[model samples]
Target: MYSPRFIHCLVSITASIVAGTFLQSTTINSEGSFTNARQSQAQKVQVLSVEFPQQQVPIVRFPRDVYPEIKFSEITQPQIQVQANKHLTIITIPTSLLFECGKHHIAEKAEKALNQVSQAINNRYSGSWLQILGHTDSKGSSKDNLQLSEQRAVAVQQWLSKQHHLNVSMVTTQGYGETQPIVSNTRFDCFERAIARQKNRRIEIVIQKLDHQV
Candidate 1:
């Protein structure tokens, strides 16, 4: 039989060991929970706080000095010819740049340029009316030239209206064959005349600002 003092001492020692073990377990669990919470918070920050680059969402504009904006699209001699007026911006796209000689079909390379134009229109000129004008030189017969010019204008209009899903009603087209000659196709030499004809064959994209903003 154990003495009373000895039994009391054993009870105290057992109680103390149990208390220490419980305390140590509680501390370990608390530390683990804190670490897990920190990891979860960091993961949430990484997932939700994603930042996009400038190129992904860049701002595009049609800058006007209160004038019409005419942007030239070319690869080799790329240029922007902006005439700042209150009413119209005439963007002159050379036929030579858009098509092969004597053909109205827009070339594969011209698609990229047209896409850029479409994107710009979507960004800034959603409310404005766009008039595309096709012109030709005096090299062909008047009837043939008229048909060709109209076809070219219609092609561009189709791409803008259908391919880009732009406002078709806001877009219009007209063809002037050898009637409005900014440069004469009448040259004494055949080579000079060809060059003049190339110049005369051009498409003008006119951006018209309406009196009331839509």
Candidate 2:
């Protein structure tokens, strides 16, 4: 029933309203996308800022004054004796006093006894050499055990060097491993005999008097 001119005017108004709504929606969508992009960039920057380099822990060495005491009853089964020669003073160190199972480094508890022994030697002899010997029970392979023994000896030597400020040349390390057995190798006696054989796994301090020829 409306005239042509009126209908044309109504259509124009409706089209303008729709175009305005669409423009508004497009503006809001663009703003939202920009905000999301900024947030993502911020998150990435924050992650990068928090990244840092990893640090390595240094090895710890104990002083010789803290060596633990070993009871005479512990080593009394066969009475392992330490021999002292003019150039060498062999000090028997029990496994019970020196190390725990599968550990090559010297414990902090054994430092005191080692210090005492070193002091005694220093008092009696001058310009002496110390050889740390590492021995193992005859249970594992010779090559593997020998390597472990050598590591143990080197660990003791490092401890002594750090504690006494001794020259590296004055100290030597050796690992005999299971090659030298002080007791018979048997299944029943293996553990007990290994404990007893701790005497052989000791540090021998060789005192070579400067006046004496090598």
Candidate 3:
């Protein structure tokens, strides 16, 4: 039979071994967690240290040349196409937009466009001659259409002169009546024919800028 003292000593030794194993396991777990945390922090630092290149995109613009100054040429916007050829700048305005359909009177909304063009011309191009030519669709009699076209052109000329402070002598007016057909109006569809007719009715402003000789 084992002595009581001997059994007590064996039990104490087993308890010590269990405690030591538990402490060793806890220390290993703590060190593993600390290493993982350090690795995570280092990865963040590495990511932040990397550099990226920045790029700048260029903006390009293409506009028909009217005047040398960009501010002055802005009046020749997309709606009013400006074409330059041999000392002349041709600015076109849709007569349908300027005037009501089948009428000689100018539309109220046309004031905005006229104001822009007038200001540009007045401020930039001094002593330049402006010629306004009115065109019409094939609808009415030649005489009546000619008279109507002339009246429409005259109305625009007067508006530019009086409202925009342009010189009356600097502007001249002409009418083409139904003689100049920009687009053919012989479409079977009503909508298509109307579209073609609208194209025919246009107001062309020709600006002649003479050379400056010192």
lDDT per residue (tens digit) for residues 1-64 in model 3:
2235423432342122211111111112122344576744443222223334444222111134
* Candidates in order: C-alpha RMSD to true structure: 32.2, 31.2, 34.5
Highest lDDT, which number? 3
lDDT tens readout by residue for model 1, 5-99: 43343234222221111111111222234457675444322232333433221111223544454443332236324443444555667777667
CA shift at 72, candidate 1, in angstroms? 7.9
Give the lDDT of residue 116 in candidate 1. Answer: 70
Candidate 3 displacement at residue 201 in angstroms: 0.5
**What is the lDDT of every predicted structure here?**
0.62, 0.52, 0.65
Ranking by TM-score: 3, 1, 2
- lDDT of predicted model 1: 0.62
Between candidates 2 and 3, the TM-score winner: 3
Error of 1 at 160 (Å): 1.3
TM-score of 2: 0.53
Q: Which ten residues in a row are the worst by lDDT in model 1?
A: 18-27
